[model samples]
Target: MNKIHYLMNREVNYTLSKCFLTRLTGWEEVPLVKTDACGLVLFRFNNDFTGLRFKLVLNDIEILTAAHIHLGMRGENGQVVAFLFGPVTRGISVNRGVVTGIIVESDLTGPLQGMSLLELARKMEIGNSYVNAHTENHPNGEIRGQIKRF
Candidate 1:
């Protein structure tokens, strides 16, 4: 039997530590960091048995995708927020059928589109968020996730 886990009433955040190229049906991690860079933020909303994620890019721009999603974005003020929503599935399907009912927001804007995270990784000199702009860059960062058991 499929154990029905209820994510229908929770909201969580996943901090993406690495850039990735995603398909409509699966995920592929991308190595987009060579030096220090700020990671993006993923806001997930569980609604009526569906999983939704959200994020923001430069200029307060936003983007949305399904749970089985992939994205690479430009960090804003040191972070990006992406919005996504759809059925939540675990494991993997050897072959996924055609994708349907993908819910994209009306206000959705392409922030990472045509942008290269790899290039950003090369040009940006990651440094302390709390440090002065003239300080030396630190080529290191971290991401953390916390979950609460109901």
Candidate 2:
């Protein structure tokens, strides 16, 4: 697993390019847990004529986001391969398909911690940060999530 840490002093933006997508592994049936501070925002997309795009909302706003992921492969084949995120509210299930981009917002006014950067941000007890996910698999770099905090 990769790890990235930031003693954030300003707002940061992370982007996922096509090359980044090619290197992403271990993204199957991953459970995105919500923490006391941050939340996971997943963007769903499709290539079909009637392609669908929507946000998979987690049920509870305060449930800590944590889970072990089993990454899988996606191709031209059209199948319902979605990563089930959060133990959200009753009847409000959150899932995304054919992820095109993901960006995590780390709103920090102090220090942070967690299993991964996302986990740390989620569990953070300070400012607001958003993790925008285009794919379910967490990216690898000097830090996790390919993030940059100013």
Candidate 3:
């Protein structure tokens, strides 16, 4: 919908590196196979909440196993929106979101000199799940989860 801005607590970086991220898709039930495949994306808001910031967690990750962005509400079968590598997280703003971004601990990148966690977390709404992987054909992801703040 609209866009908002907020800062991260510095803990988000740590949380991502330790968890698996998955996006839910389809209006009906479907199963993903490789939960631990590869090609995890590190997501965040733009420094000014205007755009999205994204990077590959693993530099060696050259393939996309299987990924889909959850669009509908939770528990609902989300559409299978295939994604390669870009600045968007399941169509959600990465650096400039109205809500939050998801990440994997092993794939979580630190808040470097150019990243702003606050502006990114402001408009977070983890309504749907974002499923991801590192291989091209690997249906099941090596890890997946919806980012959360505690």
Steric clashes per prediction: 9, 25, 54
Instruction: Choose the strongest candidate by lDDT.
Output: 3
> Which candidate should be chosen as best, given TM-score against the real structure?
3
Candidate 2 per-residue lDDT over residues 103-135, each given as its tens digit: 222321223211223333222212122232222
Could you arrange the candidates by TM-score from highest to lowest? Answer: 3, 1, 2
Residue 128's lDDT in candidate 1: 13
Q: State the displacement of the C-alpha of residue 46, model 1, in Å, after optimal TM-score superposition.
A: 3.0
Q: Of the candidates numbered 2 and 3, which has the greater TM-score value?
A: 3
RMSD of each: 18.3, 16.2, 12.4
Per-residue lDDT tens digits of candidate 1, residues 1-150? 233332321221122222221111101112122322122323333332133333412111112122222222323222222223232232112121222222233322344334433222222223111100010121111111111111
Cα lDDT computed for each candidate against the true fold = 0.23, 0.23, 0.34
* CA deviation > 4 Å runs, candidate 3: 1-40, 58-68, 72-76, 80-124, 134-136, 139-143
Residue 25 accuracy (lDDT) in model 1: 10
Error of 1 at 9 (Å): 14
* Structural similarity to truth (TM-score) of each candidate: 0.20, 0.17, 0.36
